[model samples]
Target: MSKFSFPFFFIVLLVGSSCKEERQNDTAENFTEFVNPFIGTGGHGHTFPGATAPFGMVQPSPDNGTTGWDWCSGYHITDSIISGFGQLHLSGTGIGDLADLLLMPTGKTLDVSLFGTTRDSLPYTSRFSHSSEIASPGYYKVNLESNNIQVELTANEYVSFHKYTYQNTNEPSFVIDLGYAVNWDTPTESSITLESETQIVGYRHSTGWAKNQKVFFVVETSEPIVSSQFMANSETLDSKNEAKGIKTGGQFFFDQDSTKTVEIKIAVSSVSIANAKENLISRGNSISFDEVKSQTNNKWEALLSKIKIETPQDSLKTIFYTALYHTQIAPVLFSDVNGEFRLQNDSIDSTQDWNAYSTLSLWDTFRAENPLLNILQPERANDIVQSMLAYYDEQGRLPVWTLYGNETNTMTGNHGVSVITDTYLKGIRGYNVDKAYEAVRNTMMGDIRGLAPYKKYGYIPYTELDESVTISLEFAYNDWCVAQIAKDLGKEEDYKYFSNRSKAYKYLFDTDTGFMRGKSGDGKSWNEPFDPKFSSHREHTDYTEGNAWQHSWFVLHDVPGFIELHGGNQTFTKKLEQLFTESSEISGENVSADISGLIGQYAHGNEPSHHIAYMFNSAKEPWKTQYWVRQILDTQYTQQPEGLSGNEDCGQMSAWYVFSSLGLYPMNPASAQYEFGSPLFEKATIAISDTKNFTIIAENTSPINKYIQAVKLNGESLQRTYITHTELMTGGTLEFEMGPDPNKNWGI
Candidate 1:
């Protein structure tokens, strides 16, 4: 195992080895101490040195650097200091948001600013030597020297793990206060209600990406403190302190000196106070911390096991599995036990097992990950589609950026339509197809359509509002996917409508310039100089977070058409090669690290380029695909903080790596076809489904023979990059003869 495996396996094994009964399955052995949340607990990583339930929506951790960034997800590798942990962390957010409602333990008067302290002026923050931090996939732990508090934090779906150790000495006390705000907007009203001698519940009205959200939490401790403090503008806090009425923050400390350890349990709700109370009742605090962590790990294992790829190379296997792991982290469950959930319309609704999962950046996932989900996690894909459908039913439109039940509409394009359209075409069963169709249509053609910009202006025109070029290219592709979905359902008019709509990119396609250019509403004049490179589309130029090199190949539904548009195969290949080997001139925009792996302007880090590498298959030049795909796998990704080089983009990046490493890529998800590539392992098999009990295998593969000599499905030769979902689900073996170098005309 590589050095990465130690920490990686430790987290997995700790969670997997939940109890003694399952000791037999604990095959992967390792030696490691408890975790250190303080490790990646700061800087660009956005990780908090706190406990969380695995993949659970509620992440309670300490807030040191509440300033938002991706590293803030849990902890960043860049930060060197130790701060307290808050309960909520938003993973990999480009715009630092949602490290809200911080709870820290301190003895001094409560102060919120972090400016007074410097790296040297305050050594307590850095007193945490790196040797003392323990971090795994599911757990973290560290000790605070300033206060002599040893902290251990982990997760167990919807529950957090916290173990605070107060060393045997004086100042044996702790504090829990709710006055801190985590990117919290001013609440219209705030109130703290006592539930019992040992419990407190309250509501904090705040707004940000998840606007109009009313946060309610129930906190119960293993032991009760002798006293509690409230600061609502000076209302008698204690003999020396008083509740300051309408004060911004308040805190209370534990009075006992003999107590050495303590644990806290909390539950949050977005619906109502009653629902928050119910959320607590559902989890009656009897389960051990180990048990919860173990349970959460098992849940992850079961989910991950749906698609099992067995390869001899541990790194390849680990990377593949880890990529698969990262892919499933989002579209998180946002419902309560009663099937009640917040709707996109912002109304709390009651349903029967119908829940909403948000943070689905489907514009990226539709390339490969969703297709993977349809086959391995069809049930989950169905639920996701159902949730989108439910979003339509409630919000009267499909979602863009959803938090719990709220939709932020952050990004461009309406991909919920394409996802639904593709799901229906793939023959998956989960939601009402008719309702799904209605949603697909409403989102594709909504009066205030997110996609309307593309249709009206031939391409999305960068007006005072909107990402013109990017929205155009993306909408064109999504609209094309919708056209396919429309065709399948025999909605002739809708098919023709979207089919016509899908070609809107052609208007911006400068036949003379041979690039998709941004145009104004007048449609004759193109955006000046039209350089796709160094253009930060985020400023509403033409593209979205990309330059010409990245957006040029956005059309995936019709590669042949795109190649023809580019004036044939040879020129197309030349342009693509330049895209990969060219340099990127940095523009000072928040160009998502997702746009990493710059070859000229071709960024392997983002989604637009995901299919560009595979599009070579369309020209029957499979050798190029093999070369670039292998190169991308080897160099662009690693097993460390800088490892990703881009946003996981809701598993889209991971899914791309997973799919490509398997020697197959999903060019189009709803089509049930995968573009074949060179497999990166000796042997890889997909256990089809439970009822079918079938499997697909790739044999005689290795790093040397990374080029596919030939592929046989079941027992026959294949012509194209695609294989049916049914053929895969029914089970079969895909044998291959890989070689060190390309066979000049091998896959050709």
Candidate 2:
């Protein structure tokens, strides 16, 4: 057997043996059952329990009858009815869009007005209970109470498979609502065309977080349509080749036996309608819904098997696996089956052999999700880097909150630098580093979005830019990543330039207040009337969706520098202590709802404070890091539908949980180093490679005995407070002795 493959097999076998028999079974049965997709569907989790393959373009899930904050992903547990199953969705995001090509099937006698322009007006929308609903990795099923129809959804890479079983109707009708949009999204234009009796094609252009977004789809049904009608803005038109308007809808009446199921495949593409059809034809011709579901389940099992923790606590396992599931939901496959994708300005791109990807919440993912991918899915990580480079090649800069081939530029910082640099430093080679470096250097040196003033002055001036302090701090971290890439590429001058620029964050650090605050144009004085606890909800604020207490510790590249600026470890650690123990209250006119899941002022729900708990390691207070990390892990995450304390932010929040639960975190993602924290699990094994396994074993590990007494790597005493990625990938056992009290001397 290959060397790396043995360890993965060992982990699988060992986990199988150690876990309880009821929860331990075949690879697919045990692990798949533990996944609770509904955990984040309720509350503000904004996650969809949809049927989607790993990084697939199609997210076929039920949209609830609402356009509220919790329904960002189109589905919320609190909602009373399912509007329809859309072929697209967003998981754990603040803004909601892409609930495109919504398909609702019911009995032929149902009124068309019952399915209205908005979900709230749809009286025919079916009610579904959690007891009858089922969701796994790439599958979702629900029984609609409106017409007593059972809906089952599954997906491949680019197409969604939907099976509808009507209980008493011999003739079933389906409505395609191309105009349907939810939360912070609006469909500018939409089109639906009847290609044949059994086939249909359409497109929807939208404006939202992704401006100028376009999605083309080709849907094919098992049974031929006996009759069809087109409707636009409440006006019904005779069947035609095409129907185009702002509010376009299509109704297809199908001939099917009452007992037999009617299945349909919807293929989606950002490229073109023909490409969408080609995608469906290429992959959907021979595959059955069950086969597609099985394939998707196996895909998740293989990915989840990369890290196997030997624990009897099913709740922890459920949370870990669900978090792992969230990480694969984005950086989706943009390229179609023929390796074609839409480029900037609605053009076609067919440059590479590897598939292109998008939906990069880089501002969030660069912290932990991307780094986690570098460990668990290095191949995909390399592809994602290439995709970013490809985006740079087209758009002349890396994407911010990009989706559907559009650079949304929604968030701050050119964080694609961090993602690229982190992967490069980990030795994940595939993409062109010189070109990558060019993109990174250009992004840092670009004259757009206050970078000119940021370069002219030491930092971005509050008078010139919004979120000046946060931008400067985030850009400093981005610059540090650029510096690392430059140094590795042997560009001494570039390294020197970015290295100097990386320290520009020091200019915004208010020495008197001990918080990073916005500075004036002269850089001699801070912005006036600064309340560190106050977060201005306006766009023209010093912070972005965060207060000073949260963004103050964002200097991921230089925690030591941050400590020095805060008057040494004693004062620095005390500030961190206060950040945790302080009141969970904010003083502001309009505070950001993104700042939830609060522990004192440490908002675990947002990305800004993600690394703060681990920052205690650098402050020489490892126990505090252990205490807070454990506290957040236990309190912020749960097995319920509203278990998440904050937005999933794609997978950043969940990724943090996965890493912290395992006693490791990527404090500085650009560096290969991972700061150590208290491990929540008793024994965990990571299949690093085919020939190696990195095992983490915590003895006497429990709720009370959460403190680490001692640590040994490969039976050798470990003195460092952090571990490197190289050391982890090389494979060895890291054993931790646990106790109720912290060993204070450990790692010191």
Candidate 3:
């Protein structure tokens, strides 16, 4: 037995025995049972069903192959093959990257000649069936039919635990492929060193969505490695212990044992291999696989238990909790246990006072996910803002899309400004507010992503940039967020400047077509030959992942002005009604696949139209808001593998479901107000804070009774269609009397 194996096994036995009795007596609810990690994996949802703690650094998930759009998360439900299990993965992203440090267990040794030195080539592959697969909040298990090996995976914040049970196999080997890459990811450099018989350390530096991604890892196995072959660039190296090149890997043969079980623990760090080793020693060295699984289960239970719902159907409960589970999967922990992390400038920062986070998909998340985080996970939200501020301090701009420690500068607008403004306005001031404001201001003032032309033309013109209308509208909303922060900081002049800038969306609104059309740089006329339903995928279009009908409602911060732009409340509501009742057909040679969950032209699958359903509240047509909110809640989300209507987009889609299912949504996410919607549950108790509990009760709620007839907050009748964030945080009961028919006069 290896020296590390005996102590680890002894500790496992001791801890398991000691905790058995206590665990039997404990009757805490297991919220993980309600979460189906596979709910979004089948469709364009792009979710991976794997082992990961809430915002965990290590995601030890199976990768199918490094090809195509469905393989964004490294695995798709449609694929039955497994290339290997990777340490890192992106959940529900449109673009793909980061399936680093892949390891595959096989019954036979791999032929190095059969593998090619590219992201697409697989050293070892296996077929797996869904019937033999099981996934929960922090655990994933699959039986590989090709190798007849049962693979079980679990993870904590920093380490991933893998246990492989060989079935009737003579040869049991592991192929640790450092060269493995998927989708947009390409390994720039990689290396592996066998530190000892049972220990291996390596690093994979890659480029893709995250321009400069670095992942350093330490691997420890329970069984002793009897023989090893190191390979680089598809060639076996003369050196037995180490290989260094752009493409590198190692195949290790473990000693045949009667136990037939091999356990592996992998710890990752963004800083260095030393930090990775330290992380494993501190976090994973002594813990058993079952113990780690139990710990991660408890952690997820605690977070998921924060919001408890009593629904009529078990499936609804599953769907609701699954959505909640998806919301906590990103902006994952970036700082190591010792407060060491890689800064944006390719330097290490060891002085971080708090946990740093990455995977900030600001364009999608700023709409709902960040707002939901401010309420549910305020402490982490503060850390996220701090991380963004750190990025700004190093790179002189807030992150557009950050993964690991690299900024991708993806998507559009200064939505990071919106996330910071929302976090600060929500009173989660754990971060430096002044520095945050400076980041927001500096980011907005920068001449990038069409900002220069936007400043000159008031709105981005089609002549100056593609996706002009979409960029202008999103920037306007972000400008409104900046205005709010400036106003709160008592910078009146700056506030006035940004507040005016916030109205830039009006420049693109063409009264002739009643749509926000792209304008020419001359500002004399709108871009000609426009169609509201025309959309182009990643082309020179005025919209991004959406058409005019969707981008026109991007003015979430100034709904009143937007309503006036349509002439009046009646006209506005009519146009708003048309958005959901018009033709759902989109016309283009290459229409964006993101325009899914179509209720007419209101694409619920995407972010731009997320708040559109609640716009009727401002128009005094509260019943319409309630009706459409319920419609979306019922149809857009489900419990099956292809459940989600679109890409979860790092939790924005799920966050929308979470808030809307609770009968409220952030129409303007930074506004600190939640507009009323149709609640899906009979009753939901939200542990708003450690001490405060906010409960929502829907009396006589059923499938038919989807509309609110009356409303009450704590025993008094509520007249407004919206509630303030302060009201919710203070903790009270918000009751809704539901009926088959809408009470048009209720909130109005």
Candidate 4:
């Protein structure tokens, strides 16, 4: 036997013996200790280091600015100043919105003269250093240098709990600002009312990415209010307890003490102030901040323990756990404690049977994040499908991108279809299958986002739309997802029709240039002066966030056909090799900033190129997939604030890292298949279900021994390069023998 085989066999025996007991106590592992919440807060990652529960409705974090792309999450690592701490925040998004219910605790009174001025001139701002800041999965703490106050934040599902400690100051006041808005967000109307001596209720209606957004909040303080000053648009209101206008806020004075600590809790709802109050009450007003903090920590621990990895490298463990943490921050709870949620038409729905969710970044997440959720969080996946169906019922079509209760219509394609289809195909049937099929079918058949032109012309014409080729490719993939459900439902005619529509990508392919180029309305000629590396941001371009080279390989449903389009295996493999070896420079005066994490022309930062590396498996070059996947794993991610290469895009970037590091990826997200890459750990176990566990063991796996030499599934030799979702969930052991060089003949 080889030197590595004895330990591998011994581990297999131990895992097989203890599998059932481990499943019973999966949460016994403290996986949250490995998570670093600030890994993506710097560079262009656009993630916030905040305090939030898993899929919680509230994300309370400090805001540094209201302008600039770096402040999309309201907090960046480079910033030193803090405007205030807001109740709602977006994580790793390209567009910014929802920094509502801003609260600032100060030692001195605010200047009423600067009420209507820009946020930068506000006197309540404070400066803090990174050395004095600390962040983890469910908590954040910072010492404000301006007032010598230390702030700590924690949260539950719908409520944010704040603790402030004042030192060396006599005056202790609080400012409740309803007029605070961040990038892409503008306060259309707001109001604040002091309901009691220690209670406040208000609402903020804004217009931004999600038009006509509504946020109702209820705040409760441990200390009673002594005095109050309400203002609107730089003018003090006549009413001492209330303020209502486009710009509204208030300054409230509490009991003065030299050294004091105050606790505040803020609950929010999309339905009404009454619902927000009920949500706050449901958490028990007397619950201590430390108790809530401990609860949130336990929640995170249970979720993060779903997949336990054994690796010698601590940095890899941190990166893996942090990536996993980011995936659960969104698709947050939208329903109140009383099962009340707002609809897209601004109507309240009080009969929600399941927990409603929002912040669906489907355009980016359907590729990897949703797939990961299916494996780790199958029940939440069902709720996500139900949420999409609810949106379809509220609107005529499914959500492209939604926040809170409104659809932003951001990005392209109805990728909610992909999420629903993937969920159902994975044997999760907590939703109505027929209704999901109808929703996807109607969405693709409808006339929106160039779908009418795509249906009529087999391709969206460049003359009619900006991202014609990109839309056609993405729509084709979604259509494939629709066809899968049709086939499953035994609708033969519908399946055949949609299956043909799924090939709409062929209409945009240019055999002469070997790229997916844009064609005119008449379909007579390609767009002129075409360069594969050229990119433009939402301008006269045929791509969305990428160029021809990146978008051309997006045929996830038909990779074999895509390879054939490039003239068979050898030629296609050569062209694929060139994608990473070509020049990294882009040829455009105004290129999309989304195209980042560039290794030559392969942009790992964006979603378009996420599955391109795995296409080598279809071209019969699995070794190249292993090589490139390892390269991306080593180079594109790290354990620092500036670790990520591009926007987290609501966890899609991190999801890519999580899946790729595990030696598998969902090349076709809805296909329920995972292609193997290079596994990073020696042993990784997944809690497949209540009583079952799936374990993957890689022997002699190190930086030098990166290539897979052989593989076994339950002690039998495996030949295929991919594994099915059914095979994975069946709970068996997948063992791989690692060597220094690629054994190209092993998987083939």
Candidate 5:
């Protein structure tokens, strides 16, 4: 072929590839997979520095975090050394466990301590040198100092792929602990049954946050193993259930090692072994690495497109987009090709037809994540509601921090009801609404552990429930969300009932103290010397991973009502300011590190405070919201490894950024309205749908110029606490002039 022919041929191939990718139904120009997975590796960020497609089932990365804390999602920024990457990790949870299904690559014997940490036992670890590691959001590469091996990791819907370069071909050998498990750190059973030279079905089962989680796997090796070991616990699995689990692995050998690559694909199901087998078999061994990588890249594109934010500051874009990526990564697509899934109830095989989802970090996501999903990707929102409804149908109630098919019920309060109710209210589809109503009511009014404390005490009363003050406040807001949802669905009785239930928080309010205090089980009594910051009985109440100062503003559904609770708009505004800058002197409980964007007592780091900035619209002053929103956009967020100052909280943290940057936030998610907030970009363009596009053009908009001088919708002056979904979806221009100083009287 002539040189010109080769060039023309290459262009044709590129165009053809682009056309083929277009078939996946994702926007292309918007996605850049250059995310550094190692960004959050330091700090108690709990992120695995690994590579995976946006929202894919696989999270292939090194499992460097062995601290067994909630932050160990991947490797900790504070750790001194590296550990092999694990396939699956639970996201942003308070409990430490389930670093299940690990994959390690080596050029020599794996000398690292499987137990994690050496004899000196540093109280806290030193930061990992950045020179030793590299990460982008969708992919990660790390070099182990001890082994001198370069390890790369990536993930797709349910499979993890790894590439390792050994220092020397002869010294290279890898390890797979069929017996490995995490934080409920004891493995009850493990076995590696060699199915053949190239395939192995390994199994291991142990107890952790999800008790009695039986893990079974069928791993097909890309190469043959020269040496492999099978280690099982002294105990054996109940013979009857042996077909289902008891962890095991398959190791392959090579005649001699060079820079050979080992790819291990895995699928985890709450359902059956056969389904897992089908899941594995569906992706035949002949598939190319680039094909899988491309599939993941495109998926990332679609997810990233769901919310697009462009800015002059590249760092802001990285932070905004990365946070956006993190939110959609979990509660992933849980169904297989035939729609087989692990049912809500563990016995499995019940639903070989529909869909099932697990790993719902509801308490955190119920605030921002689900609402964000409802607004942007309503279709997926519907499926998530249906999945939770299915949980209620099969498990008998809406889940409380559900994992795998089991209910760890880790967090306090029932917020998934809010997710269901919020989605349903928005006229979103893909769920059985009536069934969802049933589940919502059951969870709200049913006989769960926290209900009596909720119903009888208005909020969980101290005399009635230990975390009385904390539980009462949060329950009240969620109660309102549920009731609002019920009312929208025309469940009149439920509407009235839950509406009253939501007001239960009023009882806990100590007008004299001007704080939410614990009430006694008896109608007239209250906790003595009430300090909102302190936990009553060390129970996870009076705070859902927060303090009374933090929980005081939990009522985002009815911000006006929350203002009313504070006496009036003026007083409420004063307290609101105090909250943003509130300092904790007592230091009651050890709080999560992600709760760091402090404005006095207000915490922008976690979900509870996500809606706080918009509360300004409810007050006589909207400028404060402008001030803090700009401060957060400029400072709390950056395009660096530790870009986010708080928990990704499954994406709530990032969703908050995405919405804020777009000059809008779901001030009231169920209300089908977006509250205007400070815009971070000079010009933000949102393509709401194929035919509808929206743009925000700021006049003198910048980090210093934070206030909105004025507002206009399409060309008309607009003054409203909220914007309608109609106006937004109509896709028009929202223009504003901003300044560093608050234009306090402008919006008011």
Candidate 6:
């Protein structure tokens, strides 16, 4: 028997007997302790280090001021000065917006004029050290050196709680900034009113990616407010009615002394102030700070327990759980306690049966994040599809990249179709299938964006629109998703039509260059002066965020057809090899920051090339896929602040990590099959449902054991390159014996 395995039972130990004592001592660490909230706060990770429950709408995190771009989440690890804690924030996104309801603690005697209402100056900001900061899964703490104050933050589903400790100060004040907008955000109107002496209720209307975004909040404090003042653009406002401006906030002085602590709770809603107050009273109050923290941690533990792994490496556990944590940050719960949520039409939805959820980020998430959720969180998956259907009911079409009851129309393709179809095919049937089908077909059949041109010409023409090539390719994949649903629904005619439309990727294939290139509107010839490696900074280009090399293999729905187009597997394998062995340099005049984390021409940082490594399965080179998958897992992710390679893109980047680290990749995200790669852990137990748990064990596994030697499913010999979602849900053990060298005959 291998050192990592037990003889009688199928329990997974370590690789050696010497590590038994080490494992015994490490049993006290909860899964939450392995989560480092700061992993993606630095560099281009674009993740927020905040206190939030799983999929909670409230995110209370310190903002270090923003210069746009890297400050998408309103927080950066490089900045030492924290202006305030924003109740709402973005996670791992390319654009920034929600930094709503900024609250900052200040010394009562501090000069207000020096700071002003804006965070552009001193009094509103304070420098803090990382040494005094503590961040776990659902809690965050930091000390401001300038004010001798300590701030701790925690959250429930819709409400956020703040605890402030003052030392050597008799007077303490909390600044409530209602109109403080972050990057790409402009506040049009805002209002704040002192309801009694201990409560404030208001709303802020802004224009940004979501266009007409409205956020209402109800803030209540444990202490009484002795005095209050309102300001707009740093000037004191005498108007008690409403304050309207780009910069508006309030200052409330509390009756407190030295070494005193005050607690505050804020509940927010997109519907109305009444719902916000209801949310606050129902979910936030009647819970102590420690109880809130404890309950939040318990919620995180319950969520993390869905996928349990036994490993001796602390680094592996940290990275795995952190990646999993990132996957649950978005697709936020948008419904209130009464199932009340705002719709895209600026009206309230009072539906009691279906709950609404926003933050789809469909362009990025349709790749893997939503697919992972289909497996781990099937019920939430159903709710997410229902939420998209709700948007479809509100608007004429499905959401491209939605948030807070608005469609940003960012990125490309009818990708929501991919998410819906993938979720439905995974055997999750909690949504209305007819409505989903209608929404899916409407995205393709509607004459919106470039879909009309794609249908008319079999592909979008470059002269007709920019990014015509990638848009056509993505639309083709989405059409494939629609076709799958059509086939499942017994609509044979629709299935045939959509299936034919799904092959539109072939029109852009420049047979001479073996790359998917752009063609003019007339379809007589390809676009002139085509540089396959060239991409724009952020504007119109032949591709979305990548060049032709990365976009070539994006046809994940038809890798076999792609291989056939290249003659056979031999030529296809050679071309696939070139994607990782070609020139490593990118030569565009103004390249995008998203086109990073490069391994040769294959960019892992962005979503385009995510499934490229796993395509080796179709080329009869699964070992190469294993080698590169392990390489990307080790080199691309880390336990540090700047651990990620690029924008976590909501959670797609981390979803790729979570799926690939477990020795599987959903090559076709809309399909139920998972392509095998190299498993990083010795054992992983997945709780598929309430009554079943699936376990995957790797025997004789180590750092050098990157290839599979043999495999067994529940002690029966297994010989397949893919596993079905149904098989995984049946509750069984999949064991693989690992060796230092490739046993190519095992799965092939």
Per-model TM-score, in order, reads 0.87, 0.95, 0.95, 0.95, 0.87, 0.95
Candidate number that wins on lDDT, 5 or 6: 6
The segments of candidate 5 whose C-alpha lies over 4 angstroms from its true place after superposition are: 1-30, 108-129, 234-252, 257-259, 349-355, 532-541, 582-584, 589-595
Span of ten consecutive residues with least summed lDDT in model 2: 1-10
Better of 4 and 5 by lDDT: 4
The whole-model lDDT of each prediction reads 0.62, 0.83, 0.87, 0.87, 0.63, 0.83
Give the per-residue lDDT of model 2 (tens digit) for 241-330: 567887787778876553357889999888789899899989898888888988888887777888888765766787888888888888
Model 2 TM-score on a 0 to 1 scale: 0.95
Per-residue lDDT tens digits for candidate 6, residues 326-399, read 99999898999889998767988765576678988998998889988888888788888888888888888888
Per-residue lDDT over 405-464 for candidate 5, one digit per residue giving the tens place of the 0 to 100 score: 667876677778778767776677566667777777777776566777576556665655
Predicted candidate 4 versus true structure: per-residue lDDT over 206-319, tens digit per residue: 889989789999999888888888889777777879989988898878778533888999999998999999999997477989999989998998888888888866567778
Quantify how close model 6 is to the true structure by its C-alpha RMSD in Å. Answer: 5.1
CA RMSD (A), model 4: 6.4
Q: What is the lDDT of residue 181 in candidate 2?
A: 77
Model 2's number of clashes is 5
Clashing pairs in 4: none
**Model 2 Cα displacement at 382 (Å)?**
1.0
Single out the weakest 10-residue window by summed lDDT for candidate 3: 1-10
